[model samples]
Target chain A: MTKVALTPLAQSLPASVPFVGPEAQERAQGFPFKARLGANESTFGPSPKAIAAMQKAASEVWMYGDPESHDLRQALAAHHQIAPENIMIGEGIDTLLGVLVRLYVTAGDAVVTSAGAYPTFNYHVAGFGGTLHTVPYKNDHEDPDALIAKAREVGAKLIYIANPDNPMGTWHNAARMQQMIDAVPAGCLLVLDEAYIELAPEGTAPAINTSADNVIRMRTFSKAHGMAGARVGYAIGAPDIIQGFNKVRNHFGMSRISQAGALAALRDDGWLGHIREEVSKSRERIIQIAAENGLQTLPSATNFVAIDCGRNGDFASRVLANLITAGVFVRMPFVAPQNRCIRISCGTAAQMDIFAAALPGALQAAHDNLG
Target chain B: MTKVALTPLAQSLPASVPFVGPEAQERAQGFPFKARLGANESTFGPSPKAIAAMQKAASEVWMYGDPESHDLRQALAAHHQIAPENIMIGEGIDTLLGVLVRLYVTAGDAVVTSAGAYPTFNYHVAGFGGTLHTVPYKNDHEDPDALIAKAREVGAKLIYIANPDNPMGTWHNAARMQQMIDAVPAGCLLVLDEAYIELAPEGTAPAINTSADNVIRMRTFSKAHGMAGARVGYAIGAPDIIQGFNKVRNHFGMSRISQAGALAALRDDGWLGHIREEVSKSRERIIQIAAENGLQTLPSATNFVAIDCGRNGDFASRVLANLITAGVFVRMPFVAPQNRCIRISCGTAAQMDIFAAALPGALQAAHDNLG
Candidate 1:
């Protein structure tokens, strides 16, 4: 027997990760991927200004970043038009979710989310030993009403919904989101994940309301600002809930270089507009490529389009596997119906060209494997 | 009443930080610190190669860092002559400590540490609802026997000790540390924090033994590598405990630039040697400055010196306050006996010169402030 023992909750958790990175996949496949599109990372890259800022901050990394992340919080506050007291900066949205789950979910507490939403959230809930209740998506979009009903049934302490959702690229606009927020059950808090909001059209997000005690909005530089590797994300909520993060967070966890990069990225609106335009074009290209292959595509409000394989999850899994084998990295939903479609992230023209070239052969191989 | 409720454990935690950063102090003081000689950060800066690597990686921030931290972990493994599975890279040692605490100490579990030791560990213990039992320092050194006895008494799940210790800058040699490790109570893990080990004398750390399930050694780029802001730290331990981090860690939380920087920093041994020589000189200079001010300095094995203020915690607090007012940043221990000394981190010649220039007035001001 090992001399050291893990806590019961920790012992019960599986040593599985939410997502395996493309680098790990490449290592397994024993070759580099030709087109990197698996994770919903912005292939368009961060603002030049952000890159410059990170480079400048690189030499100044000997000192610990301001534990409070003061400057970045101030900048984020200005950008969001919320008081600095309403914001809490974290290493990433994943880290923030972990901390949030720790705050609200103790052992056996209930938490609710869409079945095929961000696995990282469910990972945290399970990590904390929270009993999770998942509602299935309604026509690929997260069914907010069903989620609320489940939360009410389970008496969940927290409810999670991601706008411009992952894996399917489906979204609900402000009115629908506000309605969900309004019906968040008396004692439950709504975790409104807006990680992909910047990629969606305007009116997709509700206005910032720091007065509402039951809702917190999570945002990230990983998508529109294109700094996923920098690991910067923030949450906006009521002052009390925001301040509660201070009780459990790794106070000095942020990277100083990332703070500077995020600050610079937030200041550059033109780069974001350019990225939106580029992503729109890439989405169009992905749709056109799917059309050429006689496949239908899900309408994407985010950086990725879901290509419908017009069959089942197993066929789409085969298509995804063949795509990865063909040196193009892409992902798909894990649940049924949605898993019938393989999700592809928007990439640069060259990457799209590579994906376009690989798809036809990959689809033919999947069909051939049907025998 | 707030609609959102924190878990009972989280609600019980106070919203206090372990350390108020120098940046926050500067903001409060309405000016910047002239000598950044606090927080135990190496003001000498990271290796030039590290800075260059980070700068080069700046644009690549669009892609998420490898969730497994493949390259960095492999390099760390080679550097330590351990298998890759023995290492777990984290955002920093602080984050790793939090995860480790979560793994071992559930609510109401016992954790042991030295009084006036690293408060961040205590902070994490409190955050996890662990009952921390601190043994008083024996002659300004961590009392390993006392810690072990207390762990036995309280049935602690974990014991934390920082060699080349923080706040006091004192340490135990490898043989002494190995003895302590041997004495760790059964079922308790020993968290040997070696954050300052890179600056200590040879033989300060015990040999790496990944088979030892009861001990985990944390190493960082923050001290001698001079990349505190980069947020790169790792643990060497039995593969089971090391792999256990995957159960609770933010897998994609590392900054890509930081991964590149730490990998480059680890490769540049000459830079590390140069830093050690410089830190030794700075330590001597700080001792001399303390003597010149009619104060005594503790024997130090790390990059900082703890100068005895010749009175008590209140006096040392006054001295630290005056130093900050005079534009030199410094810190003090939180608990008694050791708190009689003020801690000053090693800095460059220019920064040491600033501390030298500011010492007399700060001393006088501290004396004057004594009622």
Candidate 2:
């Protein structure tokens, strides 16, 4: 009997995961890591009010979540001071990016992003059979000018940029970002992923302008609100672009419990203030630890810091491997000279102590192994 | 300035939601649904253990859920007496169907299903640019033979059947289903959606066969397990097809709280048994209420019962509208002869009372409006 055949595009695509969770690593190693920092999830838990809301929502799990996600969208609209029509919610930024790509990029269409930027975005583009053009990062920051230039050159349909970017935690000021936004090619849509914006410095994000048809900004509760597992993220864009999501999106995708948790988390300003302060302290601690170990650290506007290993990619890889072996979970950028650094997330004092204690030994082990 | 244009396929598609949610209706009506029986969700609620597990998982929402979903898949495998490779978990059957369409149906591919089967499936097929060929339902049941015949006639890549079916709550026995499975056209996959399977009679489902490359069975926690809001569903299929999901699925889309809740719910067979008993009672109550109103109820193998209004689609539509106005959120079939009936979900005793009280008044109002 002839077996069912996959589409030619599906057959050509690789069945590879974008990012492996720490749980998988723990399973492979037969033990849990002493410090959970990989994947850039907030080590600080979500607000107590959010937890309470989720617990209450648990009993209501028999009813499907609102397909429109009305209450949460209303809360977000009021928070952003934008009309609800300008926002579109999804399971997460990952899911939103997939839908966005499907809407704009057909087979053989061109999309552009930074070389070492979010792999998940690239995965979505590839899954849709879109031709991706990568522009290299200039001085560890996503070079917006270069990206716009490449988009124009390639006649790209979409260009992706993550301000306060992942892996390196580097960001551009609002004025610089505005310049990049203004420079976007007429026909190209700029995807500004602000997943880490809530934790970034005040001027890191440009003002929200929902009238701009050329840009869509993605925001997630995963990093700053400490609800990564809840999988709530949204896009702020022109009403037409936001409405276009209904053409292909799974309308009832969001979890009811997650909606409750995110709404509560958004309202608990005191908890957010506490998290910001804690994240700031943790960043300082991470920087101090790097300095104490005689390593240079990249200035991070997000909750993670990129510590330069002062060597090539191979050396940094060894350091990361040793750190994982020593029960500290950390990751490094995929492309280098960025790969010459290891990325570590901000955690509680106890978790940071574990990382600090493990780092010197991990470095020593890497040196010994290299020698 | 030229705005970034959507792909030709996306541009051709209208941005219409497959189902207008009860919440949207409630919003329009400026109130909440008193008895939400439209969506076929279990009002019996999830197991207390599942609720507890979700409440516990809420505190740990800072970490991303296991991308592999190892523990839940392993548990499902053990429960089904199959290998873990045979199982693939998704955000929901809705999301899985979308991914499945993306995998097998490229532009211009043909897919087959009953005409009034599930609008969401049709939505996915259209979203992927697949041409859907639908056969009319036979005597309120999804005619498997007709579906198979159409699949063969059209050289279709997929055929979707939900048994015991939605809207009509009718089903086929295992032997008949086995015949359909055996008759699947070469290179055509049969998507057996068993969303309400647990509530069906013991002999309703065919034996699980992961060796069959042309068939995939979908199961969900939404109905019998009473966790619709958690959005957990799994597919049992050949390992190759299951692995193919990894190519396009959002790897980290599932919520950790949901995973924990589903795991707990699956292990609590007592709660499931209780839910089955409760749903059976509720179904009987609904049938009795319909009979009292001089309406005929269809034979149901699922949680909901379809009450025939003894009139045309327009009359049934009026009954549904009046029901909604009376705060009884029930739905009716979408197509011709079947649209003569209104579908009501099994609910708690209190909710059933509300539905029962509202049905008489709704019927009277519908008659008055029609006259």
| Residue-by-residue lDDT tens digits, candidate 2, B206-253 | 999978898999999999999999999999999998999999999885
What are the runs in model 2 whose C-alpha is more than 4 Å off? none
Instruction: State TM-scores per candidate.
Output: 0.99, 0.99
The candidate that achieves the highest lDDT relative to the unseen native structure: 2
DockQ value for model 1:
0.80
**lDDT tens digits by residue: candidate 1, A1-371:** 34878999999998878878999999999999999998888999999999999999999999898889999999989988888999999988999999999999998999999988899999999999999999999999999999999999999999999998887898999999999898999889999999989989999998888889989999999998899999999999989999999898988858999999999999999999999999999999999999999999998899999999999999999999999999999999999989999999999999999999999999999999999
Model 1 alpha-carbon miss at residue A18, Å: 1.1
lDDT of 1 by residue, B1-371 (tens): 34967898888888878878888889998999888988889888999999999999999999999889899999999999999999999988998999999998888899999988998999998988899998999989998899999999999999999998887989999999999888887898999999999888999998888799889999999999999999999999999989899898897758999999999999999999999999999999999999999999998999999999899888888888888888988888888989999999998999999999998888888888885
